[model samples]
Target: MKRRHFLISGAAGAALSMARPSWAMAGAPAYLTAASKEGNSTWLVGLTEQGDVVFELPIPSRGHAAAAHPFRAEAVAFARRPGRFAVVLDCATGKEIARLDSPEGRHFYGHGAFTADGKLLLTTENAYDVPDGRLGIWDAEDGYNRIGELPSGGIGPHEMIRLADGSFAVANGGMQTHPDYDRAVLNIPSMKPNLTYLDAQGLIVDQVEPPADMRLNSIRHIAADDTGRVVIALQWQGNPLTAVPLMASHRRGEALAFFDHPETVRLKQYAGSIAISSDGAEIAVTGPKGGHVLFFDGATGAPINGRALPEASGVAQFGDRFAITLAGGLLEGGASGGKMLDVAGGYSWDNHLVSIRRV
Candidate 1:
């Protein structure tokens, strides 16, 4: 298979044999995201692959990340960090089916994933007092109850994904915070961010840390393609004026490779979200702080294009184009440039948008 490479537009020419995405094979794509308002009210919205809003369910409070079930129309909307609850909604009916509470002395980390079989929901959490990162396991079929927890391998673990081989790739952000300081980072000078691989049984099998110079570049969000190759987005805790690699790549056992940008000074020090192109050959990293969705070649990790999007952060792929959620609506961007989809509604989209997919 001949793979076409573009810096920001990766999935342009890669064939199915090359991308090998099971969800793409199944057809009819959809996505889920948590949107909110200033009044503290929130919602979990679902959208068709064409960027049309399909369903919306009111949530109890603010939300950050969400996980959609692979085989069913169900989603778990997690409250932003320091929050203690997650609501499981039946997307087919827009009804709240269950509410997951953080165990005492712990708080939800606002991101989670379901196993390949959809039996357990794994959430990142910060253990109270002790202040270490933990993955809370919820039995999806058993009323979404807290069953147990596993070590996150680092502090302040943020986003995680289930890989094709059934192992989990977790981005342990490593910046400890307590509700005490209103989410103020406490370990910027010594934060040890790492990409950790956890097996089905929740055991850490491998780990890769960032280079010494970029230690403050926190690995915050992550996405994996068909081959289990992961691209990580980071939030820099160092001086904002110093241009640094806000993205990197890692395989299970290899050293994490930080990417260099041609316009380092122009790259936002913070990446709110990241998405790998269907062919796994391109990457889109959104920087709402800088108001642009920067695209890169997945293979070479070089800058290809940077499209200006006001408050552009949320991003996901439907088929050929990337769907980004901003206050204006869902914007579709590709080789031809960016345009808004005709999706309508009162959605105040958040920092991240997720494509519904198979693990």
Candidate 2:
């Protein structure tokens, strides 16, 4: 089957307007950025507190994910093309400030974060056909220059998080695909997935792999706590299709333990996007295939609560509230399909950022 084109065009703009609700008329823009899968563009949909889109700004590429600088108002977005780099957009003007590309032809695997002082930008890159990936370091303050690339230590380098201690923790999902976007003859057999730790200079400081029994569980996204404890979300790749869900943690060169999701077999198709609360009190993981966002007590890995969303993809934590992006019901299904559902009061089908505050 031909892969679906994920871009929104000028013609669909009118239909998108019709999908807007009356509630979109009032309030402050609650969302900062929205990734429009159908448009293959990231929209700066200005929103109000009342969950309305005030205005819209189109980004340059088909951005899968974005990271807002911790201190500055700028953000960096990643595209899927190998050897392709990220684009820096001015949040205030919605203009492209810089285009950061990789020299090694390694496409960024959709993840990036700004350093504490806002001087450094860290991102992940993976070769579509190669065994190993790379960690890219860039100078954020100076035109987003490529400083160097670090060994990602695994197959598919998906996401990375900066720890409080200044080290970096990366979740390297072990799977190789065709650089030309060809799925035929692409899926490799018995790929080994692992987690790697590195310092600011990109040297491998530590690493961890899955147990022999669960080698196919690819560690993809990750979130870290104040104490250097890293929580990894796993995506399954192997067969049998009926196996336990493996979620694990790593800290100080020791693997604490791994917790299995109660509904492992049922959650096999879910892509894991993990987030830790700002206070380090709660850890949340979104399973889009399972239609649920599962939360657990940070310290014990015990289940706390889980909420159902149409198709949750991204999860983030503000001060005391948790925010998530609900894409359309189907992962690859386009907007015209009946599978897409309208959000209660916010945006639709396209990626929307919504926050729920704790009472």
Candidate 3:
């Protein structure tokens, strides 16, 4: 991939002086996300699991999500989907260390993950001209250089996560989009969203899709539990009133076991984000469009419980429970039955809430 990389003017020295040796410094955050306030100002934020803000760094534009390095106090904040840029920040000093630009005809899909060793960064991308999905590999240990690319095994790969065994799983949302058309779905009738598993080298090991009848259900967001079973969130691209299965769980070499309980139908045909409990026993799917958060048994795909939360936008594992973010700056459910915390500061949380686990 041909692109430009820049160290923020004059911040290089500060980065060298203040960069932490590890993520054990005071105020090391447990979660990372992107938020936006008035006038389109945006920031990549770090927070403790209990809703305390650890740090916030400015970004050039609205970001979709961010990838926290497993070992370092650094993050790569991705511009919203189809956006051409991602900024790398040195969290210890709150400095912009580097900038990544997509090559011609390719754009970031708004999400990425660092390898377990924190030596490599793998990002989801759109080879839009080919209408294909690509994984951009970067040398995280060497100034975040773009080293190579890999096929994503399908089209429209959105979110990618490193699995327990060092492989990866990706959600290929399947609806083709191009920046020229500005997020318009180009092939609704033929859309075939799928969840694909890749070996450590990025070769497809296994892939599966929703039942043929649910072909229009776009597989967008995904989360993996401790056992390597993946839970996926879907957005219906067909009739809004239709009650189709919106969540499913899968293990490689096994068929997708869907969670089609009655509550799923109430999600308004869209699941905006998903999370698997740290213990691998529960799952949460947020439907901002439907105005609710639904829980399910992580192993069985059965309904556990759900709650109505207006404009709920992001969800991630927080201890035994899940932390949820709502529009208007409200963060709740960080701990089991925990009270709500208003951290909005006039900014709304974006689509994904990422946990920064120690390697």
Candidate 4:
């Protein structure tokens, strides 16, 4: 501890400064997440840059991902997929300020993103009865009200990212399922997974689809670098023994390039999470089923390296490298080398992790 204590002090000061006007002092945003302990207690947690826990608040149910407000030290914790509830909390005070509920026939897909201006919140929703994907809009300036929604361009929208040009990219997993069926995929013979780019108003700008033979590859998770290049992770819905690419990168006006790692065959065709390094030069991904973390070159489909982390699922930027979260703890490598860190608090980590920059 000496290092922990020092970083804790700095983080405390940062938290205090966040309460003041941004011109007076700007406190960097802490990493926020939802973690569970033995499936009993689920919490939304904040941590400093050095992996120190700053605050933890018990959520009513399991949370899959969270999005931090750009200006205020606030966060919104999303419930797991097929969920109907999400909680908005004040990170500084650890209080629940609001709750977002799905409309009568729709449910959340457990992920969301905020615009740079922080004026609106966007979420992926599924109209189970009508069987379509939607982008739920909320009025941030007006108390998180459900303002309206727009079409998400395809079915089973899982994750999305805002681009540098004020647009959105969605990963349409292309599988149809209803909560009543308990995660049983309803469509397989004609599953049409696609990566769609939408304008800020939610109009389809463009879309990319895999070839005829790769339809079983579902686009589930996504990450983008500072330069607006997007990388997507795939989960194979085909046979267990068949091997396929688990990752792909997309650039505007260019075809999607599948990362062809001769060793990707070992991933078992499942990647739970995806994240880019701080410098935008490397992409990191993790697989819970295969118990491994792999890195790919940002510009090429070449595999840089790989590491093993049993039950590893979450991948996020950690300083110069990326961190992997598992039941045992958090690993700070998966790039150069793997080093264990103590941030799990003896809890089982969920599938995705993200870094937040306050101010």
Candidate 5:
């Protein structure tokens, strides 16, 4: 169980130079990211729209999510939250391109996004010393160099989505933590999570938080459509028996609207991931702890469908349908049909399926 860290070797350098023009030779995966585990080893996986693995590159540890280069056959797999390493892979050649190491006193939150132009990489980070959330900017053309940073407008920022207008919508989870405590929530009772919208330059354009009584809901995952409508998946830190909505939708200049689900469709107060359909008409959120996936009408904030699945975790948009993965390695769809494909090699899909749609 030796740890693997990919550096920029000569072969990897060659792969990087030809990555853009020859990506089709790399299988041209439609949905780029989802991590899989095989015993003690983990890999950053790329899949076709039909859920076939196109490329699998070994990573240092478990990856929570990945950020795909908009047009190149490159991807960055981020380590689990509070983990400091993110490996950049040359998917076209199945080679490790480079690694991003968070600066001391700072750690990644297991998610990132590439600017639409593919020139910059933005990763959600925790400046743990100040206990503040940050967006670490990287120079994509310059070996993924750490270029600058921006305030995330809250405490613990997790997943982020890039809007069509070149801004970003960040789910600031708001619970403070440090490596010393190892994921322990230091401020749950006082935690105040918000969805903060920022421009390309990282200035807060707008932000929204839950109403007074719903403050304990932690905004952890986020999804957005082309029209700028954003959906959020929340993890409740309050009493598990308390009935509360686990998903919400919002647009700029409008109040946050939480989707209502039947009591029978209990989300167990946790939503691991959220995704919106291509047409922006439907939304899906997964509650792995509750063993269910729930869909909602994107515009009206109404629950459309719910299904029970064992260990349902990562979810993403697959054309007009939704692709979901369970902890047992089942890749399936919802509403339209079921069971796209199953991953082999003792690999189980991890949290957060990211779609690598063309920019």
Candidate 6:
């Protein structure tokens, strides 16, 4: 299949460009990113297949996660800190239409999604010292008015996703912290790591717990394909210094080990992000510790190939290509500590979105 390429231009001029090589599959995608001048802000850049930044939208907060409205051209972005509200932006015009406080609290470590009809927004709240996790609902019509709240099921509800059955699947990383950002204390001794499936009204419909041996692993980020299968990314709670392999899959009530590649498995510390292709044929997981993107067959859970990327902390699928945000270099007091350090070699910023297409 011949790949189509598009050029994306920024308000200034050519920001970036993407080229879809012909060797790529028929449905494969090419991606481009628009980065922000301030690393702490949610800068939205629309791109063409040729990797050009044609339009840019500057969001008010450091957006940790985003979900495109199911049917609308707009998208919802969740801020990390300082700015605690989940704001909805007009993807086309780059305007803020609605902003509302997240029921999950002032510090949401990147978790928010939109309902199937685009009528509601769901997210997990993480306020330090606050043991209770909040599941917040916002009415999309009234500028994201808070309608209700529910238990996030566990402490530190970091990520939440919707299932095919119209239920909510959440990764409640069982850890406790103070909302002031003064301290982050982990509760490893009594850690209960599990996947909770909730009904539309936030009722627990099904629960799948990790194996007894890896109970200390905290399930963090989750991604679902068209078939309703889920792939969860885990962050270590028992020991941040320990390298543990805890990547796996779950469907209905069954759980299975997916990526056991020695090189990939050894990256227990780098399980920061996971994304599945729209058609359910490909899955990509990023490991900042390993500085690589691992690709696997979505059905078999077997490693296909991997690509080297910068310290990628977030991953997303734009059309057919994969988009990754590099934050490793953004850490304070690192070798690349200077403000506006060159990232991913050519891409520079505290936060940058890079799209990968097969050559």
Candidate 5 per-residue lDDT, tens place, 211-286, comes to: 9778888999988888888888888888877888888888899988887787324678888899887877778888
Write candidate 4's Cα lDDT for 1-359 as tens digits. Answer: 23222112212133433443341132533567778887599887776666677677787788888776666666677888888888887766567889999988889998877766666778888988889998888766666777677778899998987777777899999989898986789999889999989876567889999888788999999987767788999999999788788999888888788886655766788889998877666788788887887888766757998877787877888766777777666778656785787774766767876565532
Residue 216 shift from truth in candidate 5, angstroms:
1.0
lDDT of 3 by residue, 297-324 (tens): 7667788877877777888876677788
Root-mean-square deviation of each candidate, in angstroms?
Answer: 9.0, 11.1, 4.8, 8.4, 5.9, 11.3
Residue-by-residue lDDT tens digits, candidate 6, 159-266: 788777666788877766665643355566777767777775567678777777677777878877767788977766666665566467888767746465445654
Q: Candidate 2, which ten residues in sequence have the lowest lDDT sum? A: 1-10
For model 3, what is the error of residue 28's alpha carbon versus the real structure, in angstroms, after optimal superposition?
A: 2.6
* Residue 8 lDDT in candidate 2: 10
* lDDT digits (tens) for residues 119-172 of candidate 2: 677788865545567777676655676656567887777777667866678887
> Candidate 2 lDDT (Cα, whole model)?
0.60
Off by over 4 Å in 6: 1-42, 59-61, 81-83, 103-106, 127-130, 240-243, 256-258, 265-268, 318-359
Off by over 4 Å in 1: 1-29, 38-40, 263-267, 335-338, 357-359
Clashing pairs in 1: 7-296, 7-297, 8-295, 8-296, 10-282
Candidate 1 overall Cα lDDT vs. reference?
0.77
| Total clashing pairs for each candidate | 5, 16, 0, 1, 0, 17
Off by over 4 Å in 4: 1-29
| Poorest stretch of ten by lDDT in candidate 1 | 1-10
Candidate 1 lDDT, 1-359, residue by residue in tens: 11111111112222422332344454443777888756657888777767766677787777888887765566788888888889887665557888888988889888998876666788999985797999887766556766677889999989988898777888999899988777899888789988899876677889888889888989999988888889988898988878788878887667888886664445478888888877656688888787777788877888787777777768887565588877667787753476787667756777888776533
Give the whole-model CA lDDT for all candidates, comma-separated: 0.77, 0.60, 0.78, 0.77, 0.78, 0.58
TM-score of 5: 0.90
Question: If both were scored by TM-score, which would come out higher, candidate 2 or candidate 5?
Answer: 5
